[model samples]
Target: MRVDDFCDYDNSFPDEFYACLPRECPDCGAPMEMSEALTQLHCSNPKCPSKVVQRMVAMAADLGVKDLGEARATKLVSEFGLDNPLLLFSYEPDKDGVPEGMSFDVANGIVSQLNAKRRMTLAEYVKLAHLPFIQTSSQALFGGYDTLDEAYAALEEGGLGYVCRKLDISADSDVSVRAARVYETLKMFKSDLYQCIDFVEIIKMHSAEMVHLTAVCSDEVGFPFKTKADFYATVNNLYQNLHVEFLGALTRNCDYLVWAGADGSPARLTNKVKKARAYNEKYEEHKASGTLKEGEHEIKIVSAKQFLYILEQLVK
Candidate 1:
């Protein structure tokens, strides 16, 4: 049976199966067996550390991002009828095997109607957006605003407006930035980065189990240090492997790349000069051999801070 198929028959598992509250390990992405008797989950990997350091890292990562008190986030999540993390928000697939519709916005609206005073976290918003919905319209998942951060702040402040105001742009503009960030963030986790384009446009995944972060204008460009050649070489390969036409289109229209997938280290754009040099040499040889036609093919490194500035400019 397919690994994911087990999720469908989870109910078939005896009460003992769930009594312990077992889960997957965040670090190694391995299944963990929980022991209520021990009050902890154990990773089967004998050498795997308990991921203790990650806890502090996770907390630090959430420094400015979370506003809703743990109590409020928890309460709001429960009140919004999102008891199950998996049901927080989900996307229905279209005939093309892409996400067809989402009920997250409707869920957000419901949460607002239920409790106007409470705010939601990005994780909560993700959960709500993933909630199953039978709606006929609304293709995007995790609705209510364009961006996850905005939606999160709104959830905390009892509105999306405060987040919009922080962005210093019209609500719709902030929304666009949010959408772009979510797409980019998800892409970082998947094998096929471009597929994230369609995933953002179609499937509505939520952020509970992932890290959600965005760089703001407070970020100054750090000192420009030349990166190691190894990194740039990888970038060159990534650029070459990608469809240049697509990159050109993305470079022109894209802005802030808000990420919400795996969160540990912040995403970075390192320029590997040596790798780039090698790539150019290869291109020259390929052209001489009639393998690669002369063309301007390159990759764009959109840093988190740069991403935010780009979007701010776009909105303005």
Candidate 2:
């Protein structure tokens, strides 16, 4: 039987199997610990050479810097004595010597690629930082804040409990543990990390004024307006005080979905309508279960006439 199958069936490994396994990491001589799920053993030392090289390669890829594979990353780490992956951003081709056997052109090219990606969105920076269990879509963590310092302040002030409450994550969930770990990691290294990058800006998709009251004007026929531009012009001219922002596409943040079709007797269900309805149905379920988070607004489908009337009432 296979070793995996034997382990699954027996629920314990043979004494010989345990004896054969290394108690310490072979590369760094650090203690080896089982992963949280007990799936595999890993080096306890975060500063292990192997780990540093792997992190550099991963960070390069995450930051959209090309050609910095394992081989190149290993050489850079060894040649420059890089302690952290973030140090890769501070590489200066003119000041720092290129790794032996690597041409100046190649080194310059890599530096140029890194320079090109200096400015990044907060979500992208989080992914590049390789925070534990955090994905590229870190909007849940950094959405409301405009700057990293603001988000970090919130994290520090609220602690893990605040993060759990903000994200609607259960305190006992694995995600909460990961969130805490991420918070600790950020606290320890956020300054160094932020200093390495040129710019880290949070791009808010919807403004606070329009976040809960935004609408999308679909391009379906039968509306009184000739084009979307005409509709926008009329709305801006008449409802200037309402501050109603119109989107070109349906998004989860959108509050109102206005189409050209008549209410109750619709001509066709366009993709925008379908998406809006799907979002509404999902939010309705969340609302029923009382699991809806703040800003989780439902989309209200309305005809062009109803949209104008709603705006008029709001303006009044």
Report the Cα lDDT for candidate 2.
0.68
TM-score per candidate, chains pooled: 0.23, 0.58
Model 2, position 152, has a per-residue lDDT of 83
The alpha-carbon deviation from the true structure for residue 76 of candidate 1, after best TM-score superposition, in angstroms, is: 1.5
For model 2, which pairs clash? none
Model 2: residue 271 alpha-carbon error in angstroms: 12
lDDT of 2 at 307: 82
Report lDDT (CA) for all predictions: 0.32, 0.68
Give the alpha carbon lDDT tens digit for every residue of 76-128 in model 2: 98888776777877788789889998888988988876655554445546666
